[model samples]
Target: MLRVHSENELQLNADVLVIGGGPAAAWAAWAAASQGVKVIVVDKGFLGTSGAAAASGNGIMAPTPENWDKVLSERYCLGKNLANLRWLERVIEKTWLSLPLVEDWGYRFPKENGESVRQSYYGLEYMRVLRKTLLRLGVQILDQSPALELLLADDGSVAGARGVQRQKHCTYTVRASAVVMANGGCAFLSKALGCNTNTGDGLLMAVEAGGELSSMEASNHYAISTAFNATVTRGVPFGWASYTDEAGNDLGGYINGRRDPSFLPNALLKGSVYARLDRATPEVKAVIERSHFIAFLPYKKAGIDPYTERVPVTLVLEGTVRGTGGIRIVNDSCATKVPGLYAAGDAASREFLSGLASGGGGPNAAWAISTGQWAGVGAAAFAKSLGASAHERVVYPVGQAGLRSQSNTVETFDSEEIVRGVQAQMFPLEKNYWRCEQGLLDSLASLETLWQQVQANPKQDTVSDVEFSRRAAALTAVARWAYFSALHRTETRSEHIRVDYPETDPNQRYYQATGGLDKLWVRRDWIKDAMSGDKPQNVKVVTGAIDISGKDVGAQGIAPLPRLSGHAQLISGDV
Candidate 1:
């Protein structure tokens, strides 16, 4: 029960424009506002409760020195020699600093008698606290404003963004000196718990504006419920619970009696997986209840007692969150090669992990908070450097067609068809958790067809239809990015399990896919062995002219995103 702010006025002439309302975007707004910079945060939904940020069953990964060492070691082992160690070390350092700020903002981690309490993940309380903090600091939030596309400057830097406002059928642009792309990772491609707003807005917008993305391969099935379509309270499965098949066989035995992201999904090939808490000791149940109180409500509503019957589950497809991948920022300052453009949280953190793997939950949340601050502060400094030149640049010239509210028009594109089509195909048994070259190629072909529909269909002459068209095209792009990257990565590793390339090959090592989906490229080899400034070879190249260079609102046409420059650098620093 967080009190989300009502819809806000269209705030313009901003120093920074953060595109999401989740924790990372909120944190970015807080940092920028503290610097006396004009900041505005817009979202597809409400400020505090939007996206997976407000979801239950997530805990802060505190940077205790011992846990830090263990977590890094495990993640690196998964990343092989290709891990970006520097960025992770930075996250560990900044997370502790951030917690105190959260506490000062009237947020609290569970504690007992002056001692800190450990949680598997912070639940709803975290989102409420973050929203409270942003409002207290006088940060402006435009909820229900779904950003349709990034507005680029003459020099190819991000000038701002354009999106349609809910209720009012008007498209608006907020001008800014610097832009922070912090929308949470893409979801709903598979039936999962992430907000509907997480349709890869940040990823698609960034790549469209010439930013690079990695770990798209990680955008596979994550935290899927073993019981298909059964509503579980928390989308992520708790590690402490016992997992069993329909026949009451132990699932954890397959993975050394521990919670595993990959092995658990693989076990779903058995009869439906179910989790039970009936056998846990009273002490353990207390902890589970405290961290996951919301999870119990679903079982209660179903007229089942968790102390007796096990709940059924199935996999939910949250490509960005579960895959731990997103828009790749090149520098430690959180700036992409596109200059004023910046990315944080799930959008940029996956750059530090190999395309083949992802760090688990605690680390993922930690990255969101830390990188949010990093991008915010860095953006502030960059804007300050612009000095006289940092004046707000407007993207939409006066009087765009969709600006006026209209009535009674026929819908041209079936948006529901596009959304449902992606979710159904992305999670099919042959492709989602399990994969091979042919299956991936088929998925890519289907996604391409969706994009074709986006292009061929004429936009209706109404305001709402215009907004719908932009969103449909954007979501289609999101799926295309996921499938194309997944198809490009040849070897199997971590959550990206491919039946064809069943084993992790030493030859493939750290080669990762990057660049725009229009013209995709995988790095020549594992980045670990490269010298101080050695250039990377382009493994595969497809060149289609990418023409997204429009500043006016009329640029929303669904062209195959301009072919990437083909020279956009892939993973470099902090390895």
Candidate 2:
């Protein structure tokens, strides 16, 4: 039954509720709804137009027919230190299956004279196809409704979520047997260069619900960043770029004849990085335009060829996409430790491609399609397994008291001021590309203070003010998590370079970090071949808990997580 409390408030029922309307949520909804499950998807923006998938610079990473062996080796075994090996294998396999479906739905990959061109980043086309597929399959999408918290039953199993409808200024409850936390990553604090809503909402929900986050310390993503734009990071892979200082000296070294993500940091040492493609062959330049020419499109609009001049770029702290550390899912199932809960896309710790490397041209695109479909099917199966519980229903009590507010007048201060303070504190060397013991400690102390200041105030005087408060709170949690995770890792690994440690300790791989704001720590049971005797008894490492305080959603009388063996419970079969 479609139960409406009023036009202002809504009480809906769904068998599977997929939060966030990105590729992950869309695929999950399609799978669940296609299987005759009632699925509802909620997002902070419009369905097809919202999220990073709608942005340019995303591709499917897979082995070309001729280079399958070499590409597979590079993606999984020999080239990168992958945590989920089987998961990566499945991703590659699923790429072949998913690509044809996307093509059928009208996603045009670049083609030249009847031959399909590779390295095309599907942005707008990808999201449109996904949204159309969901609508055709009867999946209900609720845009402009950002999920605020996860709703739990008597037991800890996920029972849907509570979110605010943007225009309505009202709260709604979605009752479902299973929930998919595909709300995406936490890069919004990078001034919307990433998705504007990528502020760790799903991460916050997972932690309060007792789920663990994995490999979070790997920070720093090289992008076409500057004073004005953040969207150009996606366009860098297919452009002719340069790095020069105030003196106009070339600083970027050839890592396969162009700038690579890893090399961007060093490129910044002497000067700023710039995208210069006006000098390249027309084919390459054409591909750049087709991909997301906005990097230099401004120059073109100004009647100046980009190659004639240089546009500056820099690096930023990021999660997912270019780095790791997200909700840990087992194998290729996308199922977490909590029953009826699954994570996909950037929200999950893919750990497929190793540290600091982004296999976006092909790998990341394949991951979004593959894992999303699997998670959808997995969530549907979970809903089916609930038996009578699957059909169980209750009109959850919704009220102003049940929800958290942004400002409390007395507790709240200026949101913009705090945001600027945070970004400034993070953009510097000590906590970013150049991390050290003292610098990390300094970063942690300052963030902790900011977190306390924010927590002391939770009031919403206006809609924008509330939005600002929510964004600030979410960013603070994400930043604190990243800093602590980086501090715990004692070795210089990939993008997570600890200058003081400076060496990639082989023994460090035996254990990986996983924790929440309540207690920051690491566990080793999941690490491959990490036996108890793997390390000598003489070594000492800090494993105690540190409180990264944010607003306590736990005040809602949330249930503690139950013990369940991951992978063992996975009812796996390709979707």
Candidate 3:
């Protein structure tokens, strides 16, 4: 079924299609190919050099049977009873097994006492080995191809996807029996090193196809980084580093010899903040230099020693890239509510493991490896079940609002402005990190206005235009979902801190479910019922409709949102 329709279009067919160019996408393709099915991977960048995993070192949460009980207990407790123990147990086991496989495939783990260390990995080298192994498996890889939207079969299952080939200046369409979405998460264009391209593209495409998002309120994650630098946000070195305010006053943030995660952001709310690693021992300094040599390069160029000099520090908004929010997976197979479609890694919510808290670093890396394998296996099995009639189904493209305008007439709008507007709402620490009822409402109203602008614009004329517009729409949609979910939770829990509702409410023990484009809805779903595959009752919050001209259509007073029996939707007057 592979065809060259013209010089501008390339059509392809595969048993399984994996979207993304990260560690999760690589593992998914590997797993699918292991099932003896034809698999294709499409990435926005090169396979081995894209995504957050490729630009950072990560320590994996791999536990053996001996320590599994202790590790699982601690991690589950960290989630404050929202993390699912079953999923945590599965992640530990899968991660343990998967790491050794990587070593067997020629990745050399750090050794100690004549035994290979399996605790961590260097992102760049790890991905290179993985890319090599995948090529050996006969998996076809498509680089620099970013999928704009998903296609659906006549029966409403995901059929395949279509995207622009940036390097080729054309378009490519793939028809497949099953698809895996592992394209990572949105960072609101924060430029956090490797996360520039992680703009919730998969999340938006999935939602447009009737998929739902869970725990999006947990998407607010900020990492402490040196001023004017996006790389090297590693917190270990900061453990011994001391923080000071503009007047050189101590912040009293040293807790158990490590700085609290909230210390920097809280200090930043007032004025400038700076850090000094003067307390780091020689051993710590050596580790920092060896592990983060790239980060120190700029410092060396500027003739500044971070160990001795005062370095200004700022928190970078990581958004969903480090947060535990994304497309809701319905089962252990990482399958979404839409059949034949699966999601993994940052593209799928990790709430089953991290709940309302952030699951960046170790927990996220483990979840990526485990869920990627599960999704791939599930997709392959589904594809195999289709037998020879897989390609016979009638399919339609489901992309809208990005590839084409939601409105009939093509309208002129600045996509970059839309992206910047989203950043203004999401990237600020005071607006997103600290939550107040009025602040949430204001941010939501602004996001709604931006969303309307996106909906009115038409498809672009070039590949870059299409990608830019799509990223803008995707980021705006993600911010809206996060704010809506945050608005509904009401209670302060884990990473979701509501200043108005400062205390944790025992009654709010459910997850918030959000979906819909024109009619954005947020509903509370009982965790137990959701886990058991039963439909849970919905508790809603009213966010009155806002018009496209940035006017409040039916703005309600600053009163407590009543717990409505039915769903509460945030609609736009333009829509």
Candidate 4:
């Protein structure tokens, strides 16, 4: 068991600080430590057992040198020409190189026909190896320490971070030269396997620290899971499954050959939908069980064989955890607009690879490895330039809203109420999964009401309860950004479907960058214009405080975020 740091050691210094426990955080710590820099990784859970990847099976997207062109071409077309080709190429190359390092660390890949096949890996095994390797490389692992906010220097660059150690019931402050946000993405507390801790904590922290988010409209990704349980929703075994209505009638073209991802969600909206893997052959069934043992455990415990029995199914809203959207990175080094702050894995927007769509497993895994290394290298270089003087800079805690009451009224508010309110809007299939203008507007209104309450009263007096309070605020922030960006897009493209405007607009070939607290805003950056070095313009549609009318929610100004020193661009209106 990992022991908690001593009281005196709580407030410490490091060259690089990573805020996550998953593969991406481990890789970043490994990369930074390799450069002879002191690295510390703080996680919400145990290093090897946390995150979506640690609870399920995953595959990496690594193409051979000869197949690079063909793979990139297919992906480019699939992403509707919105992907950055160079970034995709780099991810492929870097991920291909990084996989061998895992094997060299003593993780033997399964062999077939006298050769090793390194396509997929079990979540537990992969994360355990990553944690072990990172520890061996002298990276400090601080488990059960969920970061609440980022510390910004007087010059507007990220200086360090502060969070509470859940087990110790004490606070921790790490003043580092650079910080990496690899803390995964929000799943709206959907109870997905390995995603309990992924509540957009880092996303909120980054945004509060004056970082911009991109492609958040593409965050409404849902996966098939057993209706009786919420933990096992990897969506792999469903490829061989057959779907049926409650009346036992075949729901043709639902799961097996379904092109539209929303087809099943639409069906479930009408009535209960059930699935069975009766179509899978014996060989395929064996493979499925072996690959997804955790997913089948629930079925076995319930005395049901999923391969033969009919089990009711529902769509699990993956949110941004499996979706493409997060803190927008400005360069290939995974550097965000804020200096000394980097984002990797699900914590960062994946639009450079998947555009307005989710890359599912393979691409996401490869992205984690590739981007993690780049961020680590970038952070190490920045720290080196700052040298020993890094700690001398005066820094301020930028946490607000959830940490303290934003209003003087101090209305009693429960964190659970905020979570339920956010989930009610995001989890329902009719609202977020298949969105229209009216539904979105209504949802936003309700969410804004909840957000106002959270800002007024977080209802946390103890350190351990701060995690829940922060989670509520983070989820609300993520939901608002997603909906605001969705409303701005107005056209159906990739995962962002607008029912009112049900056609992909050829002219609207742009990415939406969104961020703001009290007043949300979305900016449109045309693909061609961006390639031509043209500046993106904030859409004039809804600007200046999306006035929360008719609600008693008082006017709460945006939190005083650290003013950037002309090095970073503000996404929300002028500072």
Please state every model's RMSD to the true fold in angstroms. 7.9, 8.3, 6.8, 7.4
Model 3, 499: alpha-carbon shift in Å? Answer: 0.8
Candidate 4 lDDT score at position 398? 92
Most TM-score-accurate candidate: 3
Candidate 2: tens digits of C-alpha lDDT, residues 1-575: 01112355777889999998777788778878878888999998887877767755565675566765566666654313433355556677776666767777777777889966554446677788889878888888898888877777666788888766767766678988888888888774675444666777777677667677766776454455543454545545324555566667766566776545446666566455665544567787766566565555555555655666666555555555556667766534688767788988778765654533554445666777787888889999989888655547442421111125324545455667777767766666545777886776677667766666665454464444555665676666667677766766678766678889998775664324355553344443223322123332443532321111111112111122222233211111111
For all predicted structures, in order, the TM-scores are 0.82, 0.83, 0.91, 0.90
Candidate 4 runs further than 4 Å off: 1-9, 254-259, 529-575
TM-score of 1: 0.82
Tell me the whole-model lDDT of each prediction, alpha carbons only: 0.64, 0.63, 0.82, 0.82
Give per-residue CA lDDT, model 3, range 108-146, as digits (tens).
999899988787789999999999999999999999999
Q: Which ten residues in a row have the lowest lDDT in candidate 1?
A: 544-553
Error of 4 at 538 (Å): 18
Count of backbone clashes, every candidate in sequence: 18, 10, 0, 0
Where is the poorest 10-residue window by lDDT in model 4?
543-552
Model 1's C-alpha root-mean-square deviation from the true structure amounts to 7.9
lDDT of 1 by residue, 324-371 (tens): 667766666687756788888776746464435655467777878888
| Per-residue alpha-carbon lDDT of candidate 4 for residues 139-205, written as tens digits (9 for 90 to 100) | 8889998888999998999999988887787788999999999999888888898888899998899
